[model samples]
Target: LKDALIGMDLVIIPAGVPHKHGLTKDDLFNINVGIVKTLCEAIAKCCPKAIVNVLSNPVNSTVLITAEVFKRVGTYDPKRLLGVTMLDVVRANMFVAEVLGVDLRYVDVPIIGGHVGITILPLLSQIKPPCSFTLKRSEYPSSTILTS
Candidate 1:
């Protein structure tokens, strides 16, 4: 890892294994934390300034773990350590584009709060191209919200 990380300006770590049967969410968090810690230590030693983009699952928590690791090594930079946990946003864009019959590239949907299917509130009112639609509560899950 050391040799490969030399002079790296950016590092995308898709660490940790998939959720398995019988393993709890807490268990997964612990396992992924350990993996991220080891990788962060290596980054601190090998390429302290490299921007680390964490792609691990349970990303919201893993991102905090990465911040702690970097803090310990005195290399913590909030801006440099990012969690690439935007799958929900991607899906949102896709669906919006499909419904609007526009190019996906032109669709931009901003989600707030929790992740998709969790508690995220997609600001559909702010979606690009600004299509008008009536969003009834029954149309989407309770987790999603619509605002004028």
Candidate 2:
């Protein structure tokens, strides 16, 4: 791992146990956190100057954990660490396009906050080419607002 990360300019980590049916993000914490910690430690030692984009599950927590690991190694740099939440943005765009009967490319949704259930808030009011739609509860029964 150290050899692989040597002189790296950017490291995008998507390492973790994938989510499955009936599995919550919290359920992945134990397994994924360790994986993130181990990888962050290696990155800190091998490529401390590299920009790290974390794509692991439980990103809200994993990002924090990554920061802590870097801090422990005396290599923490806030500007250099990022949590990837693009999946949330993409999902919002697709759903909005579906509801509006518009081309997906024309829809733009900006999702903010942490990448997790409820925490993943889409700023519907800020959508470009603004439009509105009423969602009937029966038509969208699932509570999952975001999926990757």
Candidate 3:
């Protein structure tokens, strides 16, 4: 890890088992959490100023854990830490665009909350063309706001 990270400007950690093969994000808490923590520790020691982008599962939880690890090493900077969920954003945009029958490029969605299926928040409230959509509640469900 040290050798790979030397002089690196950005460190993106998508380290974790995925929800494939029925392995849910929660199922990876033990191993993935430790991997994330250890990597963050090394990053704090080796490259204290690098931007750490964590693209792990259970983002809401892993992010907090990563922050805690950084704080423990006295290198905690909210600005330097980021959670990468581009896939989530893409998924939401595509889904919403399909629902609205518009070009996917024209659909913009802001997904918040957690990283799991139920925890994802799709901010559909503010969508393009100022349309209205009813949403069922779920765990940390995503909300989408249209920007058209």
Candidate 4:
């Protein structure tokens, strides 16, 4: 790992199990946290200066965990460490485009809140194309509310 990471300017650690059906959040967190921790430890030791993008599952949690790990080894840099949420953002964009019958390239819905059920929220009020999302539109299957 050290040799592979030498002279690296950026490191994206996406090592983790994919979210599977029937797996509890706790189970996913436990398994993926360990994987992220190991990779982070290696990065901290081998390429401390590299910008680290944590893309593991439960990223909202694993990214926080990574900060602690880097801090433990004296390599924490808040500016250089980031949790990748582009997947959720893209999903929100695509979903919104498909529902509004707009071109996918023109959709720009920023996703707020966490990535899990009951926590995910699309800021419809802030839609880039200025699309409105009223309760009446919520009747459509594609426009189903992500949260109550």
Quick one: best TM-score, which candidate? 4
- For residue 49, model 1's alpha carbon misses the true position, in angstroms, by 1.3
- Residue 14 alpha-carbon offset, candidate 3, angstroms: 1.7
TM-score of 1: 0.76
Tens digits of per-residue lDDT, candidate 1, 1-148, equal: 8998889999999989877999987898899889988998999889999999998877777888888888998999988988875777787777777666799999898888754345667787899988766665225442232321
User: Candidate 1 regions off by >4 Å?
Assistant: 20-23, 97-106, 116-118, 141-148
Q: In model 3, where is the ten-residue run with the lowest total lDDT?
A: 139-148
Clash numbers, per candidate: 0, 0, 18, 0
TM-score of each: 0.76, 0.87, 0.79, 0.88
Error of 1 at 136 (Å): 2.8
Give RMSD (Å) of candidate 2 vs. truth: 2.4
Question: lDDT of each prediction vs. the true structure?
Answer: 0.79, 0.84, 0.76, 0.83
Writing each residue's lDDT as its tens digit, candidate 2 over 36-124 gives 99999999989999999998878888999999999998999999999987788888887777666689998899988977666778787
Rate residue 130 of model 4 by lDDT. Answer: 93
What digit string (tens of lDDT, one per residue) describes model 3 on residues 1-148?
A: 8898777778999987765676654567877898898898889888888999998866677889999998988999999999877777787776676666788888777777766546677777766645666554321233342110
Sorting all predicted structures by lDDT, with the top scorer first, yields 2, 4, 1, 3
